[model samples]
Target chain A: MELLLTYDVSTTTPAGRNRLRRVAKLCEGYGMRVQKSVFEIVCTEPELLTLIDKVQRIIDHDEDSIRIYRVPKGSFRTVRMFGTAKPLPHDDALIL
Target chain B: MELLLTYDVSTTTPAGRNRLRRVAKLCEGYGMRVQKSVFEIVCTEPELLTLIDKVQRIIDHDEDSIRIYRVPKGSFRTVRMFGTAKPLPHDDALIL
Candidate 1:
């Protein structure tokens, strides 16, 4: 399944980059970084659950932060093109 | 850019659904739900960062449990077809 995960960083600080990089490493093979603080990961129910657990550990923010919205499978196309009128070549390659 | 986001729910409980729904509503137009607990949202840097802040407000989990990986653009196709050999039509429409 396609997943859209977005996070809010404290700042453009080294700590933030380190945190994001760590997340990238853990999500290796299962996710792709579409933006600086956004990621897309694919996995089944069990695997997805496991990854979420890992994410919780990865971002140890004391203040409640980090929001994830689970969009239905085909919804990516509409959402991706919402703001941008033209289709992006990079996203076209994301087609299954 | 394309984004894939995955989340972990406590259970298939009412609260979980409500939480997910809240997130869905907040992320409306920018994300799609590809799975029960996973979604794909597309947004720019500022928008994504803002969304993350809203997420924290929706899911008030004392224990950290949401992990987000920001995959670079064009990485979704590779990861989507990783385990499944055959391509799914639903995802195809997701192409930009």
Candidate 2:
């Protein structure tokens, strides 16, 4: 599955900044960064669960927002990009 | 349907900035802004089509990227927010 992960981590405090960095790092391990706080992760169902669990643990449930949108494989057909950043490349090259 | 709209408008030029403002204004007419470049909109299929068309016109497809994620209605149950911004309000109060 292809998952679109978007998050907003509160950075009002020192701890919040740390959390933000940590979450970004964790996401990098799972997929490529599409935007500053957005990532395109291609993984299996179990991997998705683990990713969510790890992210949920690092975030302050009261001060952060995280959403995971499950994108069907090959759904990029509906996507239109008109910028430097190309759409997710095809090929299972991203699968772990 | 509930749609999550995210976009990255290039601001390297004066024209790009104008495009950004125009696109944002168009989105405001459709739904609530969730982040700087993110919005949560509740609308029907026709409304969604209208939004895509208007946005496509305002953006420089070669320098901007727009993504519309179709979120199933009542799917907010899986959404977790831990910040000052609450989730989309219920009650179909936004239907047009």
For each model in turn, which proportion of the native inter-chain contacts is also found?
A: 0.00, 0.28
Tens-place lDDT per residue, model 1, A3-95, is 655554443467766766876666654655544445555656777777767777767465214554454564544442211122222243332
**Each prediction's TM-score versus the true structure:** 0.41, 0.67
Where is model 1 more than 4 Å wrong at Cα?
A1-96, B81-96
lDDT of 1 by residue, B1-96 (tens): 455544444444778668767766665555565444445556777777777677777774652244444555544444321111222232333222
Q: lDDT tens string, model 2, B1-23? A: 76667777655579977987887
User: When superposed on Cα atoms, how far off is each prediction in RMSD?
Assistant: 14.4, 4.2
The 10 consecutive residues of candidate 1 chain A with the worst lDDT sum are A81-90
Cα shift from native, residue A70, model 1 (Å): 19
DockQ of 2: 0.34
Using Cα atoms, each model's DockQ against the true complex is 0.04, 0.34
Counting only residues 3 or more apart in sequence or on different chains, how many pairs clash (N, Cα, C under 3 Å) in candidate 2? 5
The superposed Cα distance between candidate 1 and the true structure at residue B58, in angstroms, equals 0.2
Per-residue lDDT of model 2, residues A1-96, tens digit only: 776777776555899879878887887777776665667777888987888888888988887777776665665545544444466654543444
Model 2: residues with Cα > 4 Å off, grouped in runs? A9-22, A56-63, A82-85, A93-96, B10-22, B60-62, B80-85, B90-96
TM-score of candidate 2 relative to the true fold: 0.67
